[model samples]
Target: MSQYGAKYKYGKASPSDGFDCSGLIFWAYGKHGITVPRHTAAQSKAGKWVAARNARQGDIVVFRIGRRLHTGLVADKGRFLHAPSSGGYVRMESLSGVYWKNKIVGYRRIV
Candidate 1:
């Protein structure tokens, strides 16, 4: 939540520099001494997969919009937080929304 409204910075992770999708996830987990990959490709495969309907808060939410992979942290049953895109900011998005629902790859729990 601290990162909410932080502008997106491709490939960067810290709050000062802003964050890309997976970078947010990387830094967040690392903050608690839990190591997670810093890129979507690796991140999508690092943990055991879980069905989205059963995903709990803090689960890694994975999505593949066409060939571009995006990752974020689940904030609730149907909402997640992430740095959405190039000009976007970190924000909570609904998993059940049409924009995201079709793109969802699944969910993963790393800790």
Candidate 2:
């Protein structure tokens, strides 16, 4: 994850270039030979649902932002790594932050 910090690009999945939200997830999992769907909606349903209280590192966190879905990789109990937006790069952020907390839908464990 350190290799990807501050690197972001819309609709790109390459680490050498950058990544979007789901693309980041796709790249990280692919590094471990785990394959996941490319879209956030499909990704939200790809793994078994885990209650937020049980979330651990590597768990996929899903969020509902207006009519679209967003995703992040849980880095710890209270933080996650994500490629925030067009102008933002991949970064670690607090899940408990008011903005993220209110948008969270659930967490999924792929492994």
Candidate 3:
């Protein structure tokens, strides 16, 4: 997913081009033949809920940024991969960071 960084677009989900937060997740799971929703709100309810402390790789990390929802895929126990804002790139970030910790709403297991 590193190849998708820096050039991310807000609504497109193409790996050769760019992606939004939910679009990135949708594309990643689609490559594995798993179908998921196209919006963060729908995606948030697509999988079973899991506690953040028990989150594992592949779990969906949901966050509430002001009045908007954001999502990322768990990369490990304490990190997640996501396509950030329109000007940001797809990157792995630590969940323990103050910014994420305070924004995190919950975790979900898509599989």
Per-residue lDDT of model 1, residues 2-95, tens digit only:
8899999999999989999999999989988999988999999988998877899889988998879999999987899999999999999999
| Deviation of model 3 at 89, angstroms | 0.7
Question: Per-residue lDDT of 1-111 in model 2, one digit per residue for the tens?
Answer: 764575778888887888999999998999899999998889999989999999999999999999999999999879999998997889999998989999999999999
Q: Which structure among the candidates has the greatest TM-score?
A: 1
Residue-by-residue lDDT tens digits, candidate 3, 1-111 = 544454568887877778889988898888889999989999888889998778998888999999999999998879899998877888889999989989998998989
How far does residue 41 in candidate 1 sit from its true spot (Å)? Answer: 0.3
- On a 0 to 100 scale, what is the lDDT of residue 12 in model 1? 97
Deviating ranges (above 4 Å) for candidate 3: 2-6
Off by over 4 Å in 2: none
Kindly report which residue stretches of model 1 are placed more than 4 angstroms away from their true locations once superposed.
none
Which pairs clash in model 2?
Answer: none
Question: What TM-score, over all chains together, does every model reach?
Answer: 0.96, 0.95, 0.93
RMSD of 1: 0.8
> How many collisions per candidate?
0, 0, 0
Q: What is the C-alpha lDDT of each candidate?
A: 0.91, 0.91, 0.87
